[model samples]
Target chain A: MKEIVVISGKGGTGKTSLVASFAALAEKKVLADCDVDAADLHLVLNPKINYREDFSGGKKAKIITEECIECGECEEVCRFDSMYYPDPENEIPCVNPIFCEGCGVCVRVCPVEAISFDDAVNGEWYVSSTSHGPMVHARLGMAEGNSGKLVTIVRNKAREIAEKENLDYIIVDGSPGIGCPVIASIAGADLVIVVTEPTLSGQHDLLRAAELTAHFRIPTVICINKWDLNPDIAEQIETAAKERGIKDVGRIRYDTAITKAQIMKTSVVEYTGGAVSEDIKQVWRNTIYALG
Target chain B: MKIAIASGKGGTGKTTIATNLTATLASMGKTVQLLDCDVEEPNCHIFLNPHIESSTAVTTPLPDVDEEKCTGCGICAEVCEYGAIAVVKEKVLIFPELCHGCGACEMFCPEDAITEIGREVGIVEEGRADGFRFIHGRLKIGELMSPSVIHAVKIAGRESEVVIIDSPPGTSCPVIEAVKDTDFVVLVTEPTPFGLNDLQLAVGMVRALGMPFAVAINRSDVGDNDVKEYCQREKIDVILEIPDDRKIAEAYSRGEMIISAMPAYQKLLETCWGRIIDIHRNWGELTS
Candidate 1:
């Protein structure tokens, strides 16, 4: 099966909106929203979850206070500054879970062995049925890290389901930023579509996203959403893409109906066969052609 | 008060509000600093146009194993949490991208062969624009150490009286690292289903960290009233509201700050800062 992942280095560039439209247009496909920190594809897909699984990523260190040595060895060795003394006068170092990277430096340094390393639940994932087809998505717990690991799990599960159902495509909605999560989403994908707007930030992040795809040796194309918002910048982006050997698959004009369709919980293609829908269809067609 | 303007969703006017508000504060004769902690794709430089006074590489440590002293007993590999190390036939392999540089491997190595070395992951820049200080980070492409760069940006400008941080969009580690120590946070979001969903996640994040926060809705005229209703039910103070304005969009596309592009927004943003200060003062004694 052919795999395509949609990402935008800058957020609010219509990545989820385009992925939803692709789900409606594609014949047989499984959707996976790898943007766990902000998974918004489900808002429009309306998935009926059939399978749920809790995802545990890495381990965290907890200070065993009762076994207290009060030696302050753990605090001295930690690089993340996760350990802090609640009371400066006379108190044991408490673990700030947010700053803790689960590096286990404190656990190993504790001379009295007063620390325990254990797995922590980071989030949950699901296999669900939607109007498009079976989909895979996840919800990250609040104040949790290791989002890259969870994204990998979602991708693997989506691929497995596609293999079982003999699906033709797997369209993944990836997160913004060129970080661990974005890398995990594009690692083994067959194609990457970067959706950007005509703003200055959009132009800047588009290059960064393209550089990431190039680093991974993944074939990538560009889709300019809300192109009419800044036609001059859009034209400049086209020239820049040409110089970088990237193709402009589509340039969707700004449409108020796009958000209106989102409020209705439907894709643009399903809501109306208007100009914006045609633009997205063109993106899909050009993308499939490029994949060949 | 030190405040971070953040959103769970991107393109929600976090940078716009941050730049304009800081400019307005500068006009009001406040000592302010703006730090763009969104290392991967920092856009504040595009609008603010600061003259970078200095550029320095932000480095992360990587374990360099001495082949002769290395017995490859596998203790280092066993202790690694990120799977960045592997021992094969008395040889070691290191995946630089996967390493978190927590000094776990070197600390646990029994053979005394492992040593830490520095690698450039990104760069931190310090500058100024219009009488206010500016700092930001730019993470190298294909690198995963954005949090480290973010930490550097925060540290570089921690002493300002009115510090405003423009954080990357998300509810995960990078976002947490940016907004955690700040006294106040402004969660910028739109009024749509996606916007509301992501905003809820961002809210839960700041709340988990025990940080006081408010909401700012962009494009408030277009979407449903679910976001407004959610904030009201939760008693979240709606600090700023900017309706769908094409002129603002046009100015932003040209990399122009709102306060500069349209002088009319000067009073609006100044008033917005007034609310932030008022709300923060009500939270009792301030830290730092």
Candidate 2:
């Protein structure tokens, strides 16, 4: 089985819109949304969840007030500052769930053993069915850490489903930036499709993403979304791709229909069979060939 | 008052709001310090064009195991949750890239063989831009953890009365670190489907931190009304709405702040800042 991840270093560059079109065009494929922190692929795909599973990437610290000696050692030792003075009225060191990194440093340093590691329900992953195929996705709780680990879980689930059904491919929509989650999504993937816009920031972020891919020695194909927005910058992007030895798969034109499809909760190909769809179809074909 | 601008997703206009807000405050002759905490991709520098004075490298401690005094007991491996240390056949390898610098391995070492060493992960640069003191964190390539550098940037700019922080995208460790002790947080987002989804995440993040915050929706005319509806349902204050305008996009492309290119936006940002202060005051009253 082959895995192809669609990632854009910067956000709002049309990664999901392009992935939705690919899902509509691809055959016998499983889909995964690896942007667990703020997943938006479901906005377009609208997957109906089939199975839900609890995800605990790490532990969270909770202080037992009754057992407290009010030692304040945990507060002094915490580098992340997750422990704080509990509302001066109470006047005890407390653990802030949002700030905690689950490092267990505070828990270990707590002289009274008041602080302990507790399993935190950081997020949840779901295996769902969309019109296109089966999709795997996850939603990380607000302020939850370890999104990279959650992305790995969702990707592994997608791969497991693909293997069970013998799907030909797995299309993954990755989060923005060359951060932990994006790295986790593209790691061990067969190929990476970097979707970028034609702008200065676009070019800069695309280069950063390409650098990350090259570090992992992953084969990459570049797709310039809204190529006409800044044709000059688009040329620079193409040149940079050549300089980096990354293949420029194809260009996607500016289209209002893509947004229209998103509003209707459908893929662009399903929304309109116009010139933009044709361009995306060509890009999809080229991407498959490049991966091969 | 230290205020931070953050969002759970990228491309949600955190820098746009932060830069413009700083410009607005400076126009009012208010002393403002703007710190860009999005070390991995600090774009506020592009908009602000701060004249960088000096930059200092930010370093974190990683365990340096002494092979000469090693027992190869693998105790370090068992103690490290980040999987940065491993013991293999009388040899110990340390992957400094994965270490979070909690000093757990050294604490658990029975032989007293582990020593903590520092490695530079990024740089914190300070400068003046648009009449506001600016500081930004720039992470080195291939550095996985960015909160350490962000912490350094925050420490470098703690004296300003009104410090505006531009936090990185996502509702993870880095964003939390940026918004931890802020007096108020402004969650910048657009009005699209992606915007609302991420706005919800950002709101939850801020609420979890127990920080007083409101939403500033940029590109409000581009997408659907779901963001507005969600804010209304959740009783989240929509402090400002920036319409989708070609002028703003053109100005952004030229690296000009919104209020700078469109002088009319100056008063709008001032009004938003005032409302933010008001909300924070009211929040303090309620909580205290």
Candidate 3:
């Protein structure tokens, strides 16, 4: 099966809107929102969840209050500053779960055996059925760490569902920036669709994202969103893409209907019958064709 | 006072607010230091037009295995949680991009063959634009972690009297690292559903960190009243409201700070800054 991820170097380049429209156009595909930190695609697709599972991305170190001798050794060894003196009166040096990276260095350094690693439920993954096909998605907890692992879990679940349902493609809505979660999403994807804007920041981030895709030897196509704002920059981006040998898939102009559709909680294709929807449909077809 | 402008959602006007606020403060002749904490995509320099004085590489350590020490045990790879070290074909491969530089692999290598090595993950630039000192970071291509660079940027400008930070979009580690120890946080957001959802996440994060924060609604007329309703219900202060003006969009398109384009907004921005200072004062009293 072919796995395609729709990502942008930066966020708010109309990735979710385009991905939702692609979900409508794809023949047989399972969707995954690998943007676990701030996932919003489910708002549009409105998937009917079939199964939910707990995601334990890592362990959280907790202080055993009874055996604790607050020698402050854990705080000294913790590079993440997860271990802190919470109570000055009680002299209790405790672990903050949100900041803890579960390095296990504190556990070994604590002489009183006060620290113990416990399974941290960092997030939740869902197996849902959308209007298009089965979907695997997850939501990372607020102020929680280990988003990359949660993304991997969702991708694996999507692959398993695709195999069971005999699907041909896996459409992933990837996270913003070149971070751990983004890396997890793009590691095994067959193709990457980068949705970018014509602004300088957009172009800069696109270059970084393209460089990363090239490093992994993954083929990529660039789609310029909001191309009307700066046509000159758009032309420059196309030229740069040609020089870099990255395919210029297409461009989507700034359409008010896109935001209106998002407000209505529906894909652009479903919300309106207009030029933007047609443009997204064409992009999806070209992407599938390129994958083949 | 150190104030960070951040939102969990993108296109929520974090940069717009940050740039304009710094410009207004400078116009009033207040010394301001603006740090762009979005290392992956630092755009404050674009709007601020900072003349960079110096740039330096920020390096992090990765494990280098000695082949001659020659016990090809997979133990080093097994201990690494970041997947930076991998055993491939009887040899160890180090993917420096994935490495967090925890030094655990080197410490745990039983063969005493592993040593730490430095690799550049990003660059930090320091400069001045208009009247405000600026610091920003740009992550190296294919490098994943940004909180490290964000931390470096924040530390670079912490000594300033009034430091303004433009944080990356999201309520993740990068955002957290940018806002930690700030005297006040200005949460810039829109009035859309996605805005409300992510704003709540941001609120939860700041609260968990024991920080004082307020909200500024950008594009107030574009979506709905959910954000204002949320702020009211949560007793969160709504310090400022910027309308969805095409002039603002046009100025942003040309990489112009709004305060520079429309000088009238300077007074309004000063008011916003005053509100921030007042709220910060009240918060300090309440917390202490």
Candidate 4:
């Protein structure tokens, strides 16, 4: 199966919007939202979850106060500043969960062995059925990290579903920025589509994203959204992409109907028939042709 | 006062609001500082068009094994939580990318076999833009860690009377690093399903951090009123509403701040600042 991941180096560049439209256009595919920290593809697709699983991405250190000594050794070794003596008069230290990076230095350095490292339930994942096909998505807990591991789990599950169902494609909505989560989503994908706009930040972020894809040796395509906002910058972005050996797949004009369709809980392609819809259709056609 | 502009979803106008606010505050003769902490895609500099006065490389510590003094006891690898170090057959392998620069392995090494060496991850640029201090961090392409660079950028804004931090999208470590220790957080969002979903996640994040925050709805006329109603129900103060205008988008595409491109926005930003001060004052009273 061919796996295509859509990403934007900057947020709010319409990666999920484009992925939702692609799900409507693709014939046989499994949808995955690797933007696990703030998963929004399900809001448009409205998936009916078929399976659910709890995810423990990493461990957090907790203090066992009963065995604690007032030596302050754990506090001295803690690099994250999570270990603190809340009650100095009592001389008992505590670990602030928010500041703890879960590095376990305090647990190892405690003279009395009072610190314990426990697996943390970072988030949840789901295998669901949407109108387009099967979908794999996840949600990371508030103030939680380890999104890279969750993205990997979601992608693996999507691949499994695609293989079991004989799917032809897996369209993934990747997270923003060139971070660990983006790396996990881009690695091993058959094609990468970078959805960008015609703003200065858009151009700069797209270059950073393209560098990431180039490092992975992944073939990439660029699609400019809201291309009419600044035709000059749009042309500039295209020229920059061409210099990097990346081709432009299509461009979509700014449309208020795109947001309206989102409010109606459907992809723009499925919710409206307009010039923007036509542009998305052409994008899908070009994507399919490029895949071949 | 320090205010951080953040959105859980990307491209929702954090930089737009931040740049305009800083420009407006500077025009009012306030000592303003704008820090672009979104190191992965630092865009405040683009709109501000600052003449960078100085640039410095931000480095993180990476462990360099001392083979001469090493016993290969594997203690350094054992103490590392990120799996950045591994002992294989008397040889220590270090993965610099995975290292968090916590120095735990170096501290716990039984044979004093580990020492930290600097690894450059990004650059922090400081300069002046329209009489306000402009500082931003640009993470090296393909670099995974952004919090360290963001932390460095935040330090540069500490001396200003008013600091505005433009944070990266997503409710993760990078966002936390940008918003932490700020007086107030202005969560900028559009009014769509994706926007609302991500906004709710951002709200949860801010609440978890126990910080006072307000919401600003950009492109207010485009989508449904679900965002407004949610804010009302949640008692989240709607500090500002920036109407969708083609001229604004065009000016943004040209890398111009709204306060200058559309002079009418100056009054609007001033009113937004008023609301922020009022909210912050009331928050102080409630806490006190």
lDDT of 1 by residue, B212-238 (tens): 889999988989999999999988899
Per-candidate clashes, comma-separated:
0, 0, 0, 4
Docking level for model 1? high
Candidates arranged by lDDT, highest first: 1, 4, 2, 3
Report fnat in order of the candidates.
Answer: 0.88, 0.53, 0.44, 0.81
- Give lDDT tens digits, candidate 4, residues B45-117: 8887899999999999999988999888898888787888899998999988888888888888888878889
Candidate 3 per-residue lDDT, tens place, A112-199, comes to 8888887889779999988788888888887887788888999998898889889999999998887677888999689999998887
Report clash pairs, candidate 2.
none
Q: Is 1 or 3 the stronger prediction by DockQ?
A: 1
Kindly list the per-residue Cα lDDT of model 4 for residues A55-167, writing each as its tens digit: 98788988888898788888887766777778857888888776788888888778788988999898999999998999999999998887888999999999999999999
- Tell me which of candidates 3 and 4 scores higher on lDDT: 4
Q: Which stretches of candidate 4 lie over 4 Å from their true place?
A: B284-288
TM-score to true structure, per model: 0.98, 0.95, 0.94, 0.97
Tell me how far candidate 4 lies from the true structure as C-alpha RMSD in angstroms.
1.5
Residue-wise C-alpha lDDT for candidate 2, range B1-288, written one tens digit per residue:
999998876877888889888888987888999999988777888787789999999999988887777799998888787888888896889898789898888988889889988899999999999788999988776777888988999999958669999998888888888888789998988877777778888887887777898999887887788889998888788999889887887677656788768899988888898899888889867556
As a TM-score, model 3 comes out at 0.94
User: Candidate 1 lDDT, tens digit per residue, A26-121?
Assistant: 988999999999999998999999999999878889988889679988988889989888877776888988888898989888888989989888
Model 3: residues with Cα > 4 Å off, grouped in runs:
B65-79, B83-95, B105-115, B284-288
CAPRI docking class of candidate 2: medium
Q: List the pairs of residues colliding in candidate 4.
A: A11-B10, A11-B11, A12-B10, A12-B11
